[model samples]
Target: MTQTEKYIWLLNTIHRSRGRGLSLKEISDKWRDYMAKEKPLDRATFNRWKAAIELQFKVDIKCNKSGGYRYYIANPEDIEDDKVSKWLLDSVSMGTTLMGNLDIKDRILLEQIPSGLVHLAPIVAAMKSNHRLQITYRGFGSYFSSTFPISPLCVKLYKNRWYVVGQCFYREKWQEMIYGLDRIEEARVLDETFKYPEDFNAENFFEGTLGVSLYEKVKIETIRIRVEYPHAHYVKTLPIHPSQKLIVDENGEYAEFDITVRPTEEFFMEMLRGGALIEVLSPDYVVEQMKGWVNDLYNVYNRK
Candidate 1:
């Protein structure tokens, strides 16, 4: 096993020991004996391993001048099931919503995950190794299929679901496909390796837009609205976005705010939801579009 894995096992052991502590000498003796039987580990290697674990895992295995070392369990007597059983159940239930649907085995596996993570390690390893992946994917229309040679760029999490934004070698285009890690039938790293495009930065790619949707060019539109109190309390507590700014208060009665956005469908709906409480008062096109949508909805309800 790697030093990191050994360190984790060692930490687990310290937590399991259930005592005042084990001294550095005691730990070294035990670890040396254990490693000697398995392979070979030097004293320096073990010290480096311990230091790495302390730095990376935020787990400080303290050593006293008296040569006593002890583990500080975040919470003692905290049984896994007793402490986090409800969380595990909720995670599995929520996983279904994120993954759409799953089979019997997948449901069981998902329920077993304490944190509800869909086993990202395998997928991440495949990506890092530059190996082609075999994935079961559902497209935009809920159509499902198994494909063997997808080149992954990065893995992304959106609203609890996991997606791999990558290049589809078979289709010859870059696409972001959501993989239900719980429903992943099988994954095999192919011998053939592919390089991610030097310029493709996932963060840079999806910087804007409310969700995962991507667009070539985005136009920023300034939206001005008037809100009156104490109903304005709603807006005061919740500004639309970080770009929102209070313009002025006319006679200290109502205030105006200017917000800049890409004018997405979600943002448009939010504006409409404000109703008469908020008036859209800028960028003639936005005003016209809102009126058009309102009229369309009105006609739909008014029709015989």
Candidate 2:
């Protein structure tokens, strides 16, 4: 096996052996079985691999001296909490799992997300160096694209799409704007750097909003909704938002839920997608907005 593959195998093996730490002999046996070759790892080689894994993956593999020197992940919580690290591990694990089942490719179906990967590396580099980025972007509704200089702040992923949120110099003032990575035609790291605002917290900035689109002066409020039948069960099992709370569970037919968030266009669209399955219970303004949306839809279809 290649070095990268060996490292991934080692990581996956150790990660799976968490809590039930593995001995050198146990790890070596698994490795041999995985590679389908008897290549026992020496103490020096094992130590090197362990150190490299920690350095590259930020995964701490510690040895328990009392338990006959068994090795396992020392900071699994760190790995779980870090989104980037968790995603990397998940992708690697999925890839490794799929590699072993190549013959059943037809059985596996996956969504093809837009190629936002091209700009991710450059944007991340600019963010790290506190440099502004010159990006050429085209909105879906726009006929022509435009280029602008922006102070790269943070990148976010939502609904299988990547977005870069930053400060854009427009109309003689700096305004916070979000650009879909897929919509960006090109991006260049500018030599001119800008100081990222000390008070700006990317996580907190997005906490009140549903998706990437955040309005400048929108109010965040508690939104309550009632979902009916089977769909209510799904919503209960997999919440619509992180702030979701079960207000009332009317047996099984219907249930009321509450979430504290800004009712943005995306959130409204999500409610619309739920269609007959859900009904907005409170916050009269939101109920009115939903009615307006339904009326618009009705108008479009009812046109003669």
Q: Which regions of candidate 2 fall more than 4 Å away from where they truly are?
A: 1-9, 36-42, 56-58, 249-251
Q: lDDT: which candidate is best?
A: 2
Candidate 1: Cα lDDT at 145: 58
How far residue 202's Cα lies from its native spot in candidate 1, in Å, is 2.5
Candidate 2 lDDT tens digits, 1-304: 4566667678878888879899999998876776565588778888888888888888889999999989989998988898887787778777777777778999999888898679999999999999999999999999999998999999998888999998998788997899999999999999999999999999898987888887758798899999998899899897888899999998768999999888888888989889999999779998898898889988999996
TM-score against native, each model: 0.49, 0.86
lDDT of candidates 1 onward, in order: 0.62, 0.87
Off by over 4 Å in 1: 1-54, 57-119, 143-148, 170-191, 222-260, 270-281
